[model samples]
Target: MAAGQKLYPRATVKKIVKAHSKCNVSKNVDVMIFLDYVLFMQTLVKEAAIDSKQAGERGISAKSIQKVAPDALSKFKG
Candidate 1:
């Protein structure tokens, strides 16, 4: 994805960006941090869905979330 496009939904993307926009950091460090953030968010959503299901609540189904929040679909996939 283009750098600009990669940071869609500026509000959410900013969390990753700002965390790395420090005074001193290697390009590699910044990239690694961003990747970690992405993976963390992805895992968080999936786990939340699973946890909700275990609790007998209507868990956030992967497919249903993808359909409702297409923009967030990337966060639900493997």
Candidate 2:
């Protein structure tokens, strides 16, 4: 994805928020949620990549992701 491109679609994000929140949310709130989601995923992937390298893996694997997911989720949890 390009630097200025959004990883998640705005409509989909808004729909998800509405489904879970049961209310309309402001555009600014949607943007904030989107940023948070993107950052969390980026952090998770980066950490998984580092873990893979440290373990002598040639590339990131699901095992690396699984190992890092719980810690990443907790760190990014609200």
Candidate 3:
């Protein structure tokens, strides 16, 4: 939820995503590109609380992440 501070580290996110969706996250480009946003989402919810559908929502996708990333990144850390 903060700069250089992952609310959900990549590995953690990948694991949760895999568990919920039964889909490996390491193989996706968009998911990779949008991972930061997904991690950021954990700040709003509980740890590993975000589901794949939520992560894939238009508002949280790669296209929208850039718009919100800066704020999301700073919400918790600094």
Candidate 4:
């Protein structure tokens, strides 16, 4: 996905950009951080969905998450 089309909302990106602007980091580094943040958030969403789904049953499994969020599974698989 494009950096601007990250899972995070526009407000979140604006906040992060504003926070990083105070530092002297290179634009390249900022972009890297932004990508990492997006991945982290996507992972969190996947994990949370799996956890919630499994909360009422046996332990969570990858297949369950795949059924719930196919794109999320594809990201990891790809």
Candidate 5:
């Protein structure tokens, strides 16, 4: 999918996180850190056509992404 398609859903979540606080994180755990970051997870949420579990195994938590994307978060059945 397109990169914008990958990034849009989590836009609000990203904004929320940036507004909250600054964090000091290391690049050694970049993949883990990036996925766990709310903004990044939101990006995954946009790709709902893909299975979320697979994303998590790759370090992107679909469940976490569902939590941050405003639209997904609100309509989430689980």
Candidate 6:
């Protein structure tokens, strides 16, 4: 990924926020949410990769992600 490139589209993030939020979402809030989501996904993938390696797997698998998801979610939960 290039520096400053967005992994999630701004419009999509705004739409998601609008759907879930009762009030209007500001640009800053949208950016923050996008960053938080990216961070969470990155952490989740990294953990899954480690778990797969520990299990002697060649790549991260669905099972590894499932096993790590709960812990990851809890850690990132607000």
| Candidate 1: segments with Cα more than 4 A from true spot | 1-24, 61-78
**Worst ten-residue run, lDDT, model 5?**
24-33
1-78, model 4: which lDDT tens digit per residue? 876675646555556776867754454564666677688667856675677666674655665565556555556552
Using TM-score as the measure, which candidate wins?
A: 6
lDDT for position 53 in model 1: 71
By TM-score, highest first, what's the ranking? 6, 2, 1, 4, 3, 5
Reference-based lDDT, residue 26, model 5 = 41
Model 2 regions lying over 4 Å from their true place = 1-19, 22-24
Please provide, for model 6 over 1-78, each residue's C-alpha lDDT reduced to its tens digit, 9 standing for 90 to 100: 999997768888788878887678887787787679899999999999999999999999999999999999998888
Comparing 3 and 4 on TM-score, the stronger one: 4
Model 2: per-residue Cα lDDT over 1-78, one tens digit each: 778997668888788889998988887777797689899999999999999999999999999999999999999877
Q: Which digits, one per residue and each the tens of the lDDT, describe model 5 over residues 1-78? A: 866565344455444555664653343343444545665445545554355554545544656455446654444323
Model 2 has an lDDT value of 0.90
Residue pair clashes in candidate 4: none
User: Which 10-residue span in candidate 4 carries the lowest summed lDDT?
Assistant: 69-78
Shift of residue 68 alpha carbon in model 2, Å: 0.2
lDDT of 1 by residue, 1-78 (tens): 766565445454445656766544444554665687787667667666765677676767665444445444455444
lDDT of each model, Cα atoms only? 0.58, 0.90, 0.56, 0.62, 0.50, 0.90
Give candidate 5 misplaced runs (Cα > 4 Å).
Answer: 1-8, 22-34, 37-78
Model 4: CA > 4 A from native: 1-27, 57-78
Model 6: lDDT of residue 44: 99
Query: How does candidate 5 fare on TM-score?
Result: 0.21
